[model samples]
Target: MMLFAVEWQPPRLDTGDLARIAARLRGLRPLESILDDIGDVIGDQDPPAAEAPVLAERLRGDLVRLEDVAVAADDRDPRVAHLVARARALRRREAPTAAHPVTVAHLRRLVGAAEALLERLTETGTLRACA
Candidate 1:
């Protein structure tokens, strides 16, 4: 029997790739506010059961888009990877019936990760506009 192991190599992001990532990050920023508004609505009153699921689905879509950018950027940061995994898990667990509390928490974490990644890009000089 032969055992083979494949090593994961991070892709080198070129100038154009970095620019695209910056644009994606900018796009994701609006989702944070959307999530906050949904959270507030959930907290303020008893809304229809369908409301949360709709918001959760939207958040899931945003997270998936962010995840695509992170993977493209070849982000190796442990925190970013963890958040991506959480987002994936949340997406997998999404149910049409109701929104789970865990989903909300994951969305918050994913948003934070997006912010952190943007900051990381700036710190590494990958995103000059952000700096």
Candidate 2:
């Protein structure tokens, strides 16, 4: 009988990769804040004219940051791509009016999508602090 010894090494992440992951984790805070603002606007009977555009712009910027991190990490998560696409679509729309229920619904979905993406990233160890 022959005995064989096998060596196992843990996966390695470079400093740049860790920095990107940390940045992504930090970016989640602003995304959550934007989602909260969107929810507040949705709760209102009449959302202010200027507020929606500002929120939408903020959301777009946050999504762009997330997308850049995802791309740098070579993340293949479908939800991340979908979330980016949705944010881009929302960004392209004219300022949403209180009368447009569909737009409100889309905003709600976008918030949900952002939350989902954040959860997935956290779960995948991609949002962990650099150690």
Specify the highest-TM-score model's number.
Answer: 2
lDDT agreement with native, every candidate:
0.58, 0.61
lDDT of 2 at 118: 59
Estimated TM-score for each candidate? 0.46, 0.52
lDDT of 2: 0.61
Lowest-scoring 10 consecutive residues by lDDT in candidate 2? 122-131
lDDT (tens digit, per residue) of candidate 2 on 1-131: 99765776767999999999999787566445644654655575634555555655665665565566667887777776776576666556664566656555655655565555556666665664322
Candidate 1 lDDT over 2-106, as tens digits, reads 976688688999999999999977766553454453454345554355555565566656667667766887877776677677667756864544355554464
TM-score of 2: 0.52
User: Which pairs, if any, clash in model 1?
Assistant: none
The number of clashing residue pairs in each candidate reads 0, 0
Tell how far residue 69 is off in model 2, in angstroms.
Answer: 1.7
